[model samples]
Target: MKSTTSALLNRIEFPVLLAGLLIAAGLWGFVELMELARAATPHAFDTEILLAFRHAGQPDNPIGPLWLQGAMRDITSLGSTSVLVLVTTATIIYLLLIRRPAAALLMFVAVAGGKVLSILLKFEVDRPRPELVSHLVNETSLSFPSGHAMLSAITYLTLGSLAARFLPDRTTRIFVLGLAVLTTVLVGISRVYLGVHWPSDVLAGWCAGFAWAMLCWLAARLLQRRKVLADSE
Candidate 1:
């Protein structure tokens, strides 16, 4: 039994082990954040962070230079549905062009399934958008989990993992993964800064999105294993 366990552990890559732990951590974080979101008023931390983006008691007046607000809006749009769709479609097409149909399909499933899951989670949480500050953009969605944060994490991380597989070295792989994480963080922060989501909303979204992306990676790994088995047979 010990030998079997050792063999199994050896079979799993370092990234796979790390992903498993992240999945658990993400789920735990989401559950805890959900409880905080259920409160009638935004948490002190949530309100404070949201207000930090604005100028002294002027919710409409965002902090930083005049150009910053516009830049932030553009950054936030990187995670918007239209942009994500376009990126995903382009990636899928590229994968297909490279004759990697399975990879293309997995990418499609990860992003699409993540979207469906995000919608369902929003409905389940039913938290309203932050009323403590004026919204910088128009958004009417239920706001427990920031959709932009969640979907950005899902799409970017999934693509990062996929791209890493093709990259030649560990440094390049890490860089790709880091960029994915950085993009996810930037999107989440942008959501809160815009007052379209509370800090907790973005936190929960990050947790759930990372978890979902890791789960899809694991699923793809399993499918590849099955294909290997079939081929061997």
Candidate 2:
């Protein structure tokens, strides 16, 4: 087991390690900020920001609980276990189509791991949903680290990174990455607009999600490199 671990670590490129470290640092700082905000004036700036976002794209005259309820349903639906399961199944099919079982397995691990971690964090923090504003959507969950935001980040980013590998040019790769980021960002924003999460909650979710995605990406790259080296030998 020790030898296996050693060989695996050896395959991780130095640059990947550096990038991971940087990402980890940023995420750690963000986590600290969230904790501070939660502890001291949890209803101050973060709450205000979230409320502003909630009203930004909302229907005029406030549609009462209907739209809000629907938005809540949509966000909650996005986090359903079935979505994760279906995504994993789709990824497997895609991997089979592309003949890359190893990468597919890596993606499955990333997404599954992200889902488990998201649940754990939700329980650990147990942050309450915002009660300050009329919810555009009704939801009942621990609000710290929005589940939809984090899951979307991990799943979409993982798939996006994998997709980038298949693109033939830098422009195409950038476009794919941009789309992934946009989707993730929009999902996070939607949580706030729907009044289901605090700004800090969404921010922490983004950090955690991005950190997990990057870590998994590094792992996948390391695995792929070792496989290539083994084939050469």
For candidate 2, the 10 contiguous residues with the lowest summed lDDT are 54-63
Q: Clashes in candidate 1: how many? A: 0
Q: For candidate 2, what's the RMSD?
A: 6.4
Query: What is the TM-score of each predicted model, taking all chains together?
Result: 0.94, 0.78
TM-score, structure 1 vs. true: 0.94
What is the C-alpha lDDT profile of model 1 across 62-152, one tens digit per residue?
8899787788899999999999999999999998888788788888999999999999999998998888788888998899789999999
Residue 13's lDDT within candidate 2 is 70
The list of candidate 2 runs beyond 4 A from truth reads 1-18, 40-43, 54-84, 228-233
lDDT of 1 at 97: 88
- Kindly list the per-residue Cα lDDT of model 2 for residues 14-82, writing each as its tens digit: 858775885787589567856754584575767667656544564332334666656655655555557
Task: Choose the strongest candidate by lDDT.
Answer: 1
Task: Report the Cα RMSD per candidate.
Answer: 2.3, 6.4
